[model samples]
Target: MNKKTFLGIAALLAVMVILSAYGHKLERGSDNVISLHKLHTLAQKGEQLTWSDFENYPFEDIGSGLYIRKYEVEGGSHLLLSGGNINLAPMSINLVKTSGERIDIRYEEIRG
Candidate 1:
C-alpha cells in the first residue's frame, strides 16, 4: 500500500516480463528479434521461410538475393532473409551478428 511496497512490486513485475520475453526468443520472439544461433541451427537443417510468414514485415534490399528487417538483436544486428523467386518462395533466412569488424565477401566465397 505504501510507496516503497508499490515500487518493489512494480520492479519485480518488470523483471519477470523481461525474463519471459527472453525465454521465448526461439519462437517468433519478442519485438521480432529471434536468437541468431537458434535460427542458424534451423538454417543448417534446411528450414526456409517466406515473407508472408512474417506477416509482411518491412525489409530493405541487402542485395544478392537477400533483404533485411529493422529488428535488432544482441551485438546490433538485423534479421536477414533471401529474396528468391517463385521457385524458392520459401526463402533462406539468417540474422546478422556483428562481433566487430566486418569482412566483405560473397556468401559462396566464405561458405566455400
Candidate 2:
C-alpha cells in the first residue's frame, strides 16, 4: 500500500459519502414548500395565520413566539423584522433564503 493508493481510496470514499447523502435527501422528497415573504406579509396583516393556510407545509409552534415551518422544496426569499415597538424601537430586518426545508419565524407579540 503506497501513499498514492491511500489517497485514491480516500477520494473514492469521499465521493461515495457525498452521493449517499444526496440520495437520502432526494428520497425525503419535497411536497410542502412555503414562501417566507408571503408569511411575513400575512403576519403583518395581524391575521393569525395557521398551517392550513399554507399549501402543503405544516408549522409547529415551538414556544416563546417562535414557529417552525417545514417545506419540501427550497429557493425562496423573505424579510423578517423584529422590534420592541412598532413605531419607535430597535428593529432589525433580515433578508433570508429558503435554502432548506426547515424555516423558523418569530412573532414576539403574537402568542397563544
By TM-score, the best candidate is 1
- Quantify all predictions' global Cα lDDT against the true fold: 0.48, 0.45
What's the true lDDT of residue 68 in model 1? 40
For model 1, name the residue pairs that clash. Answer: none
Off by over 4 Å in 2: 32-112
The CA lDDT at 2 in model 1 is 100
| Tens-digit lDDT track of model 1 for 22-109 | 6665454344544445434434434344455544233456565444433344446655555546345534455444644332122211
Compute the lDDT for candidate 2. 0.45
What value of lDDT does candidate 1 attain over all alpha carbons? 0.48
lDDT (Cα, tens digit) per residue for candidate 2, span 1-112: 9999999999999999999977765764653344544555545634344334443443333224533333322345533444344343213333345442223333333211
* TM-score of each model, paired residue for residue: 0.35, 0.33
Give lDDT: candidate 1, residue 77: 64
TM-score for candidate 2 = 0.33
Q: What is the C-alpha RMSD of each candidate to the true structure, in Å?
A: 9.3, 11.8
**Collision pairs in model 2:** 30-72, 32-72
